[model samples]
Target: MLKHLKEKKDVGFFTSIAGLMNSCSVLDLDAFERTQKAEGLGVGSEGTAGEKNMHDADFTCALFRFLQLLCEGHNLEFQNYLRTQAGNTTTVNVVISTVDYLLRLQESIMDFYWHYSSKEVIDQPGKDNFCRAITVAKQVFNTLTEFIQGPCSLNQQALAHSRLWDAVGGFLFLFAHMQDKLSKNSSQLDLLKELLQLQQEMVIMMLSMLEGNVMNGTIGKQMVDTLVESASNVELILRFFDMFLKLKELTSSSSFQEIDSKNSGWITPKDFQKAMEQQKIYNPDEITFLMSCCEPNMDDLIDYREFTERFHNPAKDIGFNLAVLLTNLSEHMPNDPRLQRFLETASSVLNYFEQFLGRIEIMGEQKEIFADFHSK
Candidate 1:
């Protein structure tokens, strides 16, 4: 441990840390770990302004002093010569400790600043050191990771830090993304649509491990508080309620009233399957249904299999789609204070039939009947 501290090579650092970690002598690290577990302290968001320290400032100061004293005992021959050169070994010790603390502190600073800023926000305090922070943080993580995994390693301790960093980083990025959106001036429909659409894109990019992890806890009560305060200010329920009403009427009147123009809405399941065999180019009618649904990502719904199977939509899937749309639109509507304002305002009703979709599917030569919704 002493040899590595003297040379401070990557291998040496890890060897030293590993040795200490297994033996469990670090008092500050132990307390910090316990605090995180007991408090359920969430991963800090990337978008937050100015950092709250990752460790107690007082504790850190004490730990640094302890480390210096502990390392002072190692490499006596080098220390003696250094003391003679300095006229006092204690003065040399102060300089070395100061340099070591500064170096580690710089790494910590870099990590905090890096991911928060882009090329644009460099002048911003949180963003100014973005690139420098990233570079420094990466180096620290790499060095620390090696140290933690060394033959005398503290692998568990290191793993805990890594996990905490990722959780905090992930939540921060998510926050920064949302802050970018919410801080803008837009209508509720625009904001909700934007957030929903954003989720569709970002959520799928996450690894399954992230989803399975306790990362959910990272969205703390403060986030929920912000959502309630800012997002709830816009009311969209009446628009959605009216939309739902029109959609409820969208089904065939003959089916709804049991009086057909010799027509039934249900196509045979076979013909429906045939239409799905067609490529993603849409006929006009399919476009209209999606527009009416107000599905912002309707263009990207193919992964749901409903894109091709629209003609195959039994009442069951139709019901499911209705539910999803209705639920999505109606959510948070009740939470908005603007609901009363909307109710007091104008009456709106539109019978929507748009087939403006950019994509559609068709089953080849098989003779299959498609639902009327597929027919333009």
Candidate 2:
């Protein structure tokens, strides 16, 4: 929309937006502050990146173009303006700073992605903004990739370019989260299609970037360690979600209540075994699996009530602990090739769990049909 800016004021306006878009976008300041105090570190550890501000799409779009054109056509003027008027002394160079800002914007997009996707119900505006963020992320990454391989001296700006690790790590976690969401069958067809497409784009782009030489000599121990820890958290949290779904279905049956005949809210191991034998809903091996889900007391009683209560609200559990971990560890992790392989393993296992659940559901339906036919 803002094609040409002849006035110095116009240049300043776009610059100000760029800075605003680069500042930290804390969705919950109190929660963030709590985490910072708990961890003894600032939110910068999680890559304090601003979410792409799309309140006025037209204005943001025009600002993006203006900044790009400034870097391309008016490179000298932009650098000169920064030299004299830019308050931020950290602007190393036009290309490096722009790339850094754009990369942080992508980071902001990830922040928004996690926030909305983790919600129980996303409003229409949230969905629209998420889609917009996805589009902006693709553009930003592509531009940054081009800029990295462009005429700029990547070696000189290696520290700034190292932020790509954060960007890549964010997408890896996103890839896992999107896959988990798809398994739940929550989204409508259109949104589902979009998520699937986004996954594909993420895979292709990330794989290409990781395999490329652009990151050569830039990997650091701190970054890789951070990513590894983040991946471990992702694997654990995803497993919790899977466990909650399966346990919820199991506890919904009358078997648990039947076993706790006295309404004591707890059942002994022997009583549980007896109930399973009478119900015949599960085989010996399956019963063993169910027993593993139980929490045992010192008296060897299975705390059915307590166990169910622990995961009664999977979303709430996730929101409190896993969500914070994902948000804090969200920034830079998983750039190492070995970690990528580990993610692939984690993904395959998650898919296998989904398939296993689907089979169980189908078998339950068949059992119900057989019972109805027998009664008829």
Candidate 3:
């Protein structure tokens, strides 16, 4: 079956399904706020009210999107079947339990401390939201997990069905990266252990689902509806995971914190102030990473190899030679008052930048790159 599935079409379709649902989860402005009303997981969302609410809606809505693709539609038809079910206690249990496991992973990142920044958003809007959302989402996930493990009599058969099996497996892979996050002062060994156990259970569950389909009487509309319901929830599970690992830098190492401007990897707050001083305008890539919060990864922005290659290329560096031409302006501008005023302004900026860079060297071990919350 894997071989028969065309890489382009199958991966494309499923991944597109994943992407769209991801958007939906974070799209709704209101539904996301509802999560905050829940207990045990609401902190650090202080000033980000609007941004956080909108972000939550976009993320959860995407989860619902994934659910619809599996079950057919997201409207009354599919939801009704899921809400009905005389004995669906079992199936709901499975979904909730899976979510609980995922929550632990999300919490690890959300609750993590020791975060640093050159800009308010790591200098990246998307990455910042991903970090905050994962924390709240993880708590909700764990709530569902306990729902299943505790008093609920989960529909062992429904959860063990074919489609639900695969959906669950996919989420396991997505959230599994949490093990590699930077987790000092945070005791996450238990979370990591539980995640590995869940991975094993996911495999077992998938087999059970396939076997059930072979022996079952008729799969029925309820079974189909449940498949969609479970799949959608699985997306939520994955979102918490992806947001934690990719954006938040949840790994155990602070390697990203040490990126050097000379190497063009990380941008510190000091990096920003230096640029603001306009010191010889950074290597263009460095400037882009600094201003835009990394077109690539927020945590690790500059790629020295790419920076050096581009800097050395005459075609590319032509854009960077603005300073050199400006130097000529500086040389000839004293002859004319109008041009001289412009020159004065330009030179002031240039001088400030040069001084800023010198200060960084002068103040070694004396001050932090980012003030207030940061300490060297």
RMSD from true fold, candidate 1: 22.7
Candidate 3, residues 75-147: lDDT per residue as tens digits?
3233333323233222222243333334333333332221321222222332344444444344333323222
Give Cα-based local distance difference scores for all models: 0.30, 0.45, 0.33
lDDT of 3: 0.33
lDDT of 2 by residue, 62-135 (tens): 54455445445324344344323344433333334544654565565566566667665544544555565665
Q: Give Cα distance to truth, residue 254, candidate 1, Å.
A: 40
The local lDDT score (0 to 100) that residue 303 gets in candidate 3 is 42
Write one digit per residue (lDDT tens) for candidate 1, span 249-340: 43323232232233433333333323323422333454343343322233332221322232222222222332222222222233444432
Candidate 2 is scored at a TM of 0.40
Q: Return the TM-score for each candidate structure.
A: 0.20, 0.40, 0.24
lDDT of 3 at 339: 37
Worst lDDT window (10 residues) for model 2? 367-376
